[model samples]
Target: MLHVYIEPVPKGQWGPIDGYRIETQDGTRLSGELLRSERLAVSQAKLHGYVPLLATVRIPDKAVAEHWTPADKAPVTV
Candidate 1:
């Protein structure tokens, strides 16, 4: 089976927006657009006949900063 590895594009390496990077067993690598979503990236790879084997998706720092809440500040649950 064709194997494809998907991972996040590091900040500033490509652009401001977080994108996905795909690497194949044959050493072929492709970086998605600055604004490409993980799903979209995977879909594009699938179109090219790459089978998903291992995928890693990282939340953008901007997004984590905006959505993350400290445990101390989280609402108490019963």
Candidate 2:
């Protein structure tokens, strides 16, 4: 499983779902646009050790990238 750093986006525009900037491997990152369920799923996956490699998810609401500028500078929550 790919362990990632999850951080909330306080100034995001994803409505009540809340935006978060996820940090992934190889300097990749993405900004929040996840539905509440999706966010919860990712969070749970990170916490639990039962995720399959094929089912592993990359970060930031499925928009994998080299990195998110704010995530690098922003403080982490939870």
Candidate 3:
């Protein structure tokens, strides 16, 4: 299970104001044109077999990264 960290795009960041950005715990970033909202970004991560986590605050791009053990990649069932 890949743990993905998600947070909103900062006020003056590169992405849209209402957009969300996602990245893995290991600092691997994921990009998408449709990540216009937090829910959409989480959904996208789920679709990629990643477990999404919401961040309380914005995380710096150059922050130290840590790897996590892989878990089940089972598809989410409605």
Candidate 4:
């Protein structure tokens, strides 16, 4: 399984999107701007012919924040 860690940073039109970084089960890290959305990030990667990884991250467990970040494993995917 791949572990995708979405580290959000202020850069583009979206906030907290440092850039899409996905880690493989073997511990390889891939970076790209196309991998921006955690929701569609995996699919985007896969659509690009990337095998989607088991995504996991833990940001501030709150409804709102100045900017969202993926520094933890709260929102997870199978």
Give the alpha carbon lDDT tens digit for every residue of 1-78 in model 2.
555545444433444435444445443554245424334534544555423111122234424433333322434333
Off by over 4 Å in 2: 10-18, 30-78
Residue-level lDDT of model 4, residues 1-78, one tens digit each, is 233433333423434444455554343556545454665665555555554533222342123343343323236332
* Winner on lDDT (1 vs 2): 1
lDDT of 3 at 12: 37
Better of 1 and 4 by lDDT: 1
Once fitted onto the true fold, the runs of candidate 3 whose alpha carbons sit more than 4 angstroms away are: 11-16, 58-78
Instruction: List clash counts for every candidate, in order.
Output: 0, 1, 2, 9
Q: What overall lDDT goes with each candidate model?
A: 0.49, 0.39, 0.58, 0.43
- Runs in model 4 deviating more than 4 A are 1-19, 56-78
* Candidate 3 CA-lDDT value: 0.58
Error of 2 at 58 (Å): 22
For candidate 1, write residues 9-75 as lDDT tens digits. Answer: 6733545545556665554675435425656655666787766433322343322333333222434
lDDT head-to-head 1 vs 3, winner: 3
Q: For model 1, give the 10-residue run with minimal summed lDDT.
A: 69-78
- The TM-scores, one per candidate, come to 0.49, 0.28, 0.58, 0.35
Residue pairs in collision within model 1: none
- TM-score of decoy 4: 0.35
Any idea what lDDT model 2 has? 0.39
By descending TM-score, how would the candidates be arranged? 3, 1, 4, 2
Model 3, C-alpha of 70: deviation from truth (Å):
16
